[model samples]
Target: MLDVEVSSLGPGVIERALGCLRNGHHAETDVPYATLSSLLERAVEAQASDVHLVPGYPATFRIHGELAPVDGEALAPGDVRRMVEAILPERVRGRLETERNFDCSVAVSSGGQSHRFRANVYLAQGNWCACLRHVPTEIPTLEWLGFPDALAARLASHSNGLVIVTGVTGSGKTSTLAALVSLLRRDASLRILTIEEPIEYLHPVQGGSMVTQREVGRDVDSFADGLKYGLRQDPDVILVGEIRDRETAQMALSAAETGHLILTTLHTRDAKGALTRLVDLFPQDQQDDVRSQLALSLRSIVCQHLLPSAQPGQRRALALEVLHNNLAVQVAIRTGKIETIESAIQTGKREGMFLLDEDLQRLVSAGQVTLETARRYASDPAAIKATKPAW
Candidate 1:
C-alpha cells in the first residue's frame, strides 16, 4: 500500500523509501542521499502542512496542527546538510553562506501537478535546520478559505484603498491574500504587481489582467525598493508581501492615497493592533502625520485565527474579525484613540464589521469548534461564555 508513484524523484528511490513506511526499513548512515526527495514526495502525498529536517532527528511532518516523526532513522548533521543542498536554489547559496539565514521556495512536480513549498533554512546551535511549508499551486477562493462571500467581495471590490490582512505566523495570511488577488483578476484591464519574499502561488494571466510577480532577493532588492519602482511600472494594484519596516508601510500608504489599491499583511493579533503597529514603526514626532495618512487611505482590516475544529474531516476552523473604515474609525485613528476602535466594530455589524471574540463565540455556538477551544483563543475570554453566543 506504500508504493506511491512520484515524479519528482527516481522511481526506484521513491518506491524504496515509501516501501520503508510499511516495511519498517531504516536509512543507513553511509548510503547516498536519495531519501530527502523521497521524503518530500511522501510528505506531499500525506497532505502535511510542513516538513521539518533537523540534525540528530528523524524527518517530521506537521499535520492537523500536530507534529509526527517519520518512520526512519535519525538524520546526522551531515545528512541534514545534504538534504538542504538537494532543494536549495543556486541563487540563495551565497546569501546562506554569508548570513546563514534565508527564505526560498522549492517546487516538486508530480503527475503534471506542481506543489510549491516555502522554505527557511537557518543556523541553530551551529548546525543548519530547515522548515518547509507546503503552498498549493492553485489559489483557493475566498469562501473556501472561510471568509463570508459578501464580506470578502466587499473587500475586493474597492478599486483604490488600503486593505490589510493581519494574523500571526502560520495563520493563512498569505493564502488569503492570494485569494484576494485571484478575485481582482476577474477584470481584464487591471495590472497586478506582487512583490513576495519568495513567490508562493504562481499567477498566470487570467481574465485578461496582466499579473507581474517579483521575489525579494531574486527579483528585487527589497520590498521598499519594489514599491518604489513598481509605482513607475503603471500598475493598477500592488501587493506588498508584508509591511515589515517603516519604508514599506509608508510606501504602501502613499500608493493607496495616489489611486492604487494596496494590499498587504501585518503580524498582529487584532484589527486595532494593525493600526497601532503600523504607526508605531514611525518616529514619535512623525506618528501623528502617519496616523493622518493611514486614516485617509485605509479601507478595511481582516484579522484571523485558526483553531482546532470539532467536526470530523475538518482539522481547523477560521476565527475572523473585520473592520471596515468608516467615519468613526477614521476619527479614532486620527485622534489616536485606539481603544474606541473595538466599540466601533461592535456597532458596525450592519456594515460587515465583526469582532474576533464574537466570531469565536459563533463558531462555538454552531458546534464547528468546542467551547473550550473557542475560550482558549478568544481575545476577551469573558466575552466567550456558554450561556449564549453572538454572531
Candidate 2:
C-alpha cells in the first residue's frame, strides 16, 4: 500500500501556485531587478574588467587581473537565467533562444551616470551563463596604459603595413589596441575604421583622424563582412578586432597590401607563434600565396602579456617581433625558414625587436615581476636564463 498526497486546489489554482513557487522560491530561477542593478553598481565600484554570473556560485568580478567573488548569496541557475533575460531585448532573447547564444552591448544607468557593458550570454550546463565586460567612457592613451615612450612613438609614426598585437586571453590586448587607436585619434587627417565583435573601447573623432567603430553582430554580421566593406569606405587605417579565421586574415593582408595601415590581435604565445599561427590558418595549397602576401605586407608583431607586478599591481610587457620585411626575413617567410625568423628576432634587438624571454629578463631585472612568474608564463622557460643580461 502507498500513501498518496492530495492537493486542496483546482487546475488553475495549482498552475498559479506552481508558477509562484518557481518564481519566488527557486534561487536560480530568476534574476530580480534590484539584484541586477546592485551587481552592476558593485562592478563599477571595484573597477572590474568583467562581471560574471554563474549558477551555484556568488557573482564574481574580475579586477586587476584577478577574479573575486562578490559578497552575496550564491545564484540559482533559474534565477540567473531570468535575470539575464530581463536585461536583454525581446529580439535578442528570441535570437539567443534560436541560436543558443547572443552578443550585444548593453548600457546601464544610475543617477544619470551611464556605463556601457559588452554582454555575451550563452547556454552552459543546461543553464544560461552571462559575462559582461565593462567599457570605459573615454579611451585611454598609450601613456595611460603605461607603454614605453619609444614604443608609443613608433606605433604613432607607422605610415603603412601591418601591426599585430598577440597575447593570450585576458592579457590586455583590448587595452593595448585601444591605446594605439587613441594615439591615432589625435590625428584629424586619417580616416580610421575598426571592426570588433563587440566594440570595447569607443574612440571619438579628434585631430586628424575620423574614427568609426563597427561591431560584429550589431553593425555587421561578421569580421569578414566588415573587412570587405571597409575596403570601399575610403579609410586610411583599419583595425580588425581579432584575426580568428583565414577569411579575416586574408582580408587584413589585402588591406595592408593596398596601403592601409592595419592593426589586429591574435591569440598566440609569442612572436614566432604569431607568425606560425597566421601561416597555419591557410590550406596547404594556399600556403605559398599566404607566405608571399605576408612577407610583402608584414610590418611588425608585438607579442605582449600582463603579469602581476611585484609592486602589488599589474603591468603589461612586450615580447616584440618587429619585421621590417627586409630581404632576409622576407626570404625566411617565403622559403619556409620560420625557425630562422626566431634567430632574426633574437639578433634584431638593435632594431627595437626582442623575444619573449628578453622582455621577461628585463622585467625580472627591473624588479617589476618575479622570475618564477615570468618563467611560468613564458613561451620557453629555457630561453629565460640564456637571454638574461649581465648585471
Candidate 3:
C-alpha cells in the first residue's frame, strides 16, 4: 500500500521519496512505492517504449513494438491500484474520483540518470490500470531524429507561419515538435512559448532563448484559453501540444497570421488529410474563411510514421510525407480542391515535397524495412511499388 504521508506530498517530494527508497536508503515508504520505481527502472534498462500495468497480468513492456511480459506473478486489482497511487501527485489524486481518466507524467532517477514517462491512468471494469511511455530526458537534434539536413534547416528557418507535425498516437510527433523547439532555441533572440497537456518535455533556458512552458490542467483550463492568453505573452514561436478543438484551430491560425510562428500537431493519416482535418473543425459557414487563412498562413505539414525496421539492432524507421506550401498547394487550398494536393506533392519534388509511399519505398529499397512492413503502413499499397526509391 502507498504511504499515507507520501501520497499527500507534491510531485517533487514524491519523486525524491521514490528515488531514496529505490536506492535502498531507509525511508518510510512501503513495498508498492518501491515496486513501481523498480518496474520503471527495469523498463528503461530494457529500452521499452511503454509499460502496462493491468489486473491479471504480470508487468508488461513494449519493446520494439512487441509486448513482452515480465517473469512474475500477475498483479491483483489492489496491487495495481496501490502501485499507481504511489506515483500520483496530490493535485491529481484529489481529482481522481471526479476525473477517472487522465494523463500525467513522472520523472524517476535510475542509475544516477533521470528518466521521464508520460502516463495515462484510467478505470477498466471498475479497476485502475495504467499505461506509461518512456520519454527521453535529452532533446535530440532534428538531424538526429532522421530529418535530412537540408529539410531540418528549412524547418528551423521559418519566421512566422503554421508548421505542423502530424502522425498517429505513439508515432514520435511530440519528439519532433520538441526537437523543432530545441532547434529554434539556438537563436537566442527568439522567445518560444509552449502549452502542453501535462507538460511532457521541460525545456531549459539554454543557449539564451527564452522558453516558457505551461500545462493545461495545471497552468491553464484548456488549449484555447492557453492560446488566447499566450498571444499577450509576446512570443515569437508558440507550440500548442495538439489542435483538438475548433477554438484551438482558430486561435492557432490567427496566431500564425498575426506574425507568430505557430508549431502544432494533428492526427491524420497523410498530408492531404491534415489540410482537410483543420478546415473540417469548423461549421460550413466558417470553413471557407479558415481555408483562406490556412492558404495564407500555412507553411508546412510533416506527416510521418514509424515502420518496424528489418535492420538488426535498429527497432523502427521513420517514413515521412512532407508537404511544403508551394504555389500549387496554396492554390489548391485556396480553391478547395484538396484532391489535387497529392499530384502537387508528386510533382513538387524540386520544391522538397515527397509522398509517404515514396519514403516507404526508399526504406524498403535501403533494406531498413521489409516490403511487407512498407505495405502495411502505406496509404496506397499499389503506389508503394510505383515510386522509385530516391525521394
Candidate 4:
C-alpha cells in the first residue's frame, strides 16, 4: 500500500507505521516496507526526477526525460491501497478510500541526508496509483539554475508588483521560485509570506528576512482565502503557490496593485502564453478589467524549460524566456495586441529580454545539447534551425 522506506522517512515519521502495516489488510505477512524503501534509494542513486507506483505495474522511475521500469513484481490492488494508507492521515485515508484522489508532499531523512518530494496520489482504472517528484534539500541559486544573475536580481528587486514563473508540470517552477526567494532573503529585511500546498522548500528565518510558510488545506482552506487573510497579515512580499482559479488570480493581481510583491507560478508554456492565460481566466464581461489590472501590476514573466544534458551524469539544462514589462509590453497587454509582443522581446535583448528559441540555439552552439534536442523543445523549430551552429 504506502511504500515509505524506513531509513528514508526516518525513525519518528515511520516507527509506528511498520507495526501497523504488518497487521495490515493485505496478505503480506513479511514486512513489505523494505520493498518500497529499496526502490526509493535506487531512485535517488539513479538521479531520478520522479517515482511511480501503480497497481498491476512494476515500480517505475523517471530519469531525465524517460521512464524506465525497475526490478519489482507488480503489486496487488489491496497491497497498493495498504501502502498508500500507511502514510496518509486518518481523514485523508478515508477521503482516499471514498474520493480516490489527493495531493501531498513527503520528506525522508536517511544516511544523514534529508530528501523531500511533491506527490499526487490517485486511483487509475480502479487501481491505486501515485507519482512523486523529488525536491532537493539544498536550494540552488539563480546562477545554478542557469539564469543571468543581473536579470534574476532585477526580477527579485521589485518591491511591489507581480512576478510569475511559468512552465509546464515538472519544468522546475518550484525550484526556480525557491531560488529567487532565497536570493531575495539574503539582504532584504522584508516580511516574506508563502502559501503552498504541502510546502515544497522551507525558507527559514534568514538574516534579513522573516520567512513564514503556510500550506493549503493544512494551514489555509484555499489559495484565494489564504491571499485574503495574507493581505491582512502585514506581509511585505507574498507567495501564492499557484493561481489556478480565477478568484486566486484576481486576488494575486489585487495584491500586486496594492503595494505588495507577489510571486507565483502558472502552467503556461511561454511569456505570451502567460499573458493570454491571465486574461482568459476571466469571463468576457470582466476580460477588459483583468487586462488592465494585469498590465498595471505585471512586473516580469520568466518562462523556463529543462532540456536533457549531453554530459554524462550532468543535470538538465535550463532554457528561459524573460519578459520584463516595459512601455511596449504594457501597451501590448492593455491594448490586446499581445501577438506583437514577440518582436519587442527579440529587439529588447539589450533590456534583458530574449526568445526561447534563441536560447535553445545558444545551448546547441555551446555543445551542451544536440541540435535535434534543441529543435525538439524549441518554440519554433524553423527559427531554431535557421540559427543552428555549423557543426
Per-prediction TM-score to the true structure, in the order listed: 0.91, 0.87, 0.91, 0.91
Q: For residues 183-291, write the lDDT of model 1, one tens digit per residue.
A: 8887447999999998999887668889999999888999999999999999999999999999999999999999999999999999999999999999999999999
Off by over 4 Å in 3: 1-28, 386-391
Cα lDDT tens digits for candidate 3, 29-102: 46555567777877887889999999888789988887899876676665666677666776777666787789
58-81: candidate 4 lDDT, tens digit per residue: 778999877888764565565556
Note the residue pairs that clash in candidate 1: none
When 1 and 2 are scored with TM-score, the better candidate is: 1
Ranking by TM-score: 1, 3, 4, 2
The positional error of residue 175 in candidate 1, measured at the CA in angstroms, is: 0.4
What's the lDDT for candidate 2?
0.75
**Number of the candidate with higher TM-score, 1 or 4:** 1
RMSD for all candidates, in order, please.
4.6, 8.7, 5.5, 4.2
Question: What C-alpha lDDT values do all the predictions have?
Answer: 0.83, 0.75, 0.83, 0.80
